[model samples]
Target: MEAAHGTSHFLRDGVVMLGFALGFVLLFRRLGLGATLGYLVAGVVIGPQVLGLIGDAESMIGFAELGIVLLLFIVGLELAPARLWAMKREILGLGLVQVALCGIALTAAIGLATNFSWAAAVALGMPLALSSTAQVLPMLQSAGRLKTPFGERAFSILLFQDLSIIAMITVVAALSRNPADAGGPPGWQLALMTLAAIAGLIIAGRFLVRPLFRLIGGLGEREMFIVAALFTIAACAGTMELLGLSTALGAFLAGVMLADTPYRHELETDVEPFRSILLGLFFLAVGMMLDLQAIADRPVFVAVAAIGLIAIKASVIGGIAMIIGMGWRNALALGLLLSQGGEFGFVMFAQAQAGLLISPEAASLFGAVVTLSMASTPFLMMLTAPLRRAAQSTEQREEPNNDGAGALVIGYGRFGQTVAQMLMLSDIRVTLIDIDTEMIDVAGTFGSKVYFGDGTRIDLLRQAGAADAEALLFCLDGAQLDAGVLGAVREAFPRPKIFVRAFDRRTLIDLRDAPHDFAVREVMESAVTMARAALEMLGENLQDIDAAEQEYRRNDDERLDAQRAAGDYGAAREMVISHQTELAARARLRIPGRPTNRTGAGR
Candidate 1:
């Protein structure tokens, strides 16, 4: 009876929490406010201070912390060692400076403005120095700006912040230690323990993990693979906890270790759902932690503190961005996007309160300020959209040189570069335009003349000689940008023969409906090359392999046309199967040594 009652309580709480989460997320997403804001709002409404739907904020927070661990794990998986190394300048330089400056400035200001001890001020400053990875990454991704220069720098800074959490937690723990417990553990002993823990993690990851995964993978069971991944994360996290280390750091290290493994994609797919849900719960828990009564008691002070925090953080970030050579608009956007006190602030404050490092009243007031500042992130980013647009518009434009040469390439990334290089090798002069300034700069180092501007802008396209160009190539990576440029080119000057590089099958289909002389899949040549190599390894002659490949290409093109004409993928797939069967039968007949089973073998 007791077990049944406990189960019922669990179910009820889960349902209520999920209900509010889904409702708010959907509502906010529909209103273009984003799901992060929605989750936070939902938590506020259902929290103890409001409707009291969930009475156990502590329990919820305990579970929600797993979300942070998994979130960092995914981040680590996505960022390989080499990639991190490439961003070391930004991560180590900008990130360290940002944290140190913010921490010192905030610490001094807080200590002077309040009656808090220096230890308490330092603790508060540490959390304030960090920004929200969970909030900012998604917002930038949704805006399709993750590959842009500003986005890359923002991500590097956030990565540093995530790594700094380990050090910050250690500092807080040391500060919170009672002076009477001086005989506990020596500083060197603690340092040795930390080093031992790290060495053990590295050894286990290098030796034990790969073999275990290999054994599980040999079973050919995807479910077992997922189980293995979860077990790995749990074991690593639990071990770190037992060692008095950060579980998030352990999880992140585990992810980095497995990043180069073949099963990385599968692990990501399996863990993505859990990470997203748990992360949302983490956000919701943060909202529930806000002290509404405290805010009501001192509304003016709370409001002022929140505003002050944003201003201080933004100014510091903006200054750093400018120093790093970012345009004023992008610097401002970066500042606004990361001005908030992060979710970690709550964790640190809660720990401080529990350890008696900070008074409850002070924690309550600071918690309210952090929550308010976080809740304003989406609004602040939205407010900066105009500045970004104006900056884009003010970019330098080049006049169209009607006398230049062979082709006007719309994008100059990896894909476009290949096409441009092939043209140049044939002694054809190519003019390139790309929005990525970095790509343009690198291309210039190799003697490639490329303009840095949005290809979708008709004015930019015209200035690049769309009217007199021999051919126009739309090799832009972004799907929306590709389609936009295609439309703009067709409308402005339809004389130039247009060629588009389709990103995928869907893009190919979409481009097929556009006015293009040719539409090529980005990977079509690579796939053909791979197939040819496979056929060669199978002892097939070049003549036969070439014939087979040609036939296959012709059939695939016909199938694509049929699919487009019918506007039905199902029929197209069936047609492809039938065509494959016919081709196989014909091949057997053509081979003199191969037996044709037209009748019974015995007969």
Candidate 2:
């Protein structure tokens, strides 16, 4: 009877979580909001206080553990030595100063105002100094600000925070003051164990990980790769535990060592599902820890603490951003970006609890501060546009008038460069901008007028003769995004003819419906080429291929026109399903009896 009741409770918990996750994802999409925020909200809704779905969060902590491990590994993969070196000034210099300043200032203030001891205040401040990378990065990517200077600065600072968490772990472990316990391992023993463990991790990661990857690669099974990644994570985490250090520190070290691998990105991709699930679980577990009834009893205090934490963090970050020469608007944007107490805060606070570094009440206060501040970031980012526009209204702006009269090619890839080269051969000038610096350097040696930067940036577009250009060619890879770029072009240079390339059916639909003058797919060009070759082999005259090409162009244009009128690909795909037979019959009629190469007969 007891066993059956336990199983039933477990089943109910799983069902509730599943329902919450489904509804959460669906609502996020429906509302056009970030899924992270949606997940957080889902946790709140299904929390013990709200729905009493997840009655015991302790069972989910193991899953949360896996999430942090995978997340740190992925973070390490992104932080290759070269990239880390590139941002050293910001990460080590500005980042270090900011963390120290914020921690000291906030801790002192809390100690002075409240009856909290210095140790308790320091514990509170330590966690609050960190910022949420999971939240900020996704938000920046969605806003198309990830490649901006401010974004780069934010990323550097976040990386520093991640690295700094290891220090926090060591400090918390060392300073642990249990009332019942007299002492821990000797200081030298602790130091040696930490060093040896770190050394062991480096040796294993450097020697073991690559060969393991090679073996996994040889298996030619994706599941094997995932298994290997999990094994490595667990092994490292277990090793750290044996050495009396936090599993996070071990996982982070493992990641840092594997950062230089060619397979790092692939590893990241493989582990992404596990990372995402774990991260969601972590957030849910955090939500479950919220003492809602307690908060309800002390609503004013919790609310004040949440609000005060955000305000203090924002003010400090804003001050630093301004001192670093960011404009008021940019400072405000960055301030909000850095205002949150991150996932590490939860980890640190949990550690503090285990070590008896803080009382239960203090830990709860820390949790409230972290959750409320993190929850407010999306809303804060929403204010960026208005704040920026307001700043622009009062500032004098310099608009560039194009000095070079040319065709502006936004991407200098194979397709884009070919178009630019062809135009140049015919004495038409061309200017290009690409985000890859190496590509630009190589293109420059060939006398190509190439600039290195993201094409979506208005400033880069303007410098690339956007206004004075005769035509704009959007021949980049990932051309579905061209529709959005076209909108920007229309706003900047509405009169220019926009020539674009579509990769497939979906992109074709996107481009067809987009407000642009010319939209062509590589499929059309390849089809024309194949037709020309077939004509040569069949002893057909030049006029035949030309006529066939013209017919193909006409057919594609007509298809696009019809699809655009329908406003979505579903209707167009249905149109294809309904008319494929009729189109094939029309092609057979157009081809004189039987076509030699049926593949090239029509698009």
Candidate 2, residues 44-84: lDDT per residue as tens digits?
A: 78877787777777668666867888888778777878677
Candidate lDDT (C-alpha), each:
0.77, 0.73
Model 2: runs farther than 4 Å from truth? 1-8, 25-33, 179-183, 186-192, 389-603
- How many times do residue backbones clash in model 2? 0
TM-score of each: 0.68, 0.65
Instruction: Rate residue 55 of model 2 by lDDT.
Output: 70
Clashes of each: 0, 0
Worst 10 residues of 2 by lDDT: 395-404
Residue 101 in candidate 1, Cα distance off native in Å: 1.4
Tens digit of per-residue lDDT, candidate 1, span 272-324: 77889998999898788778888999999899988988998899999889998
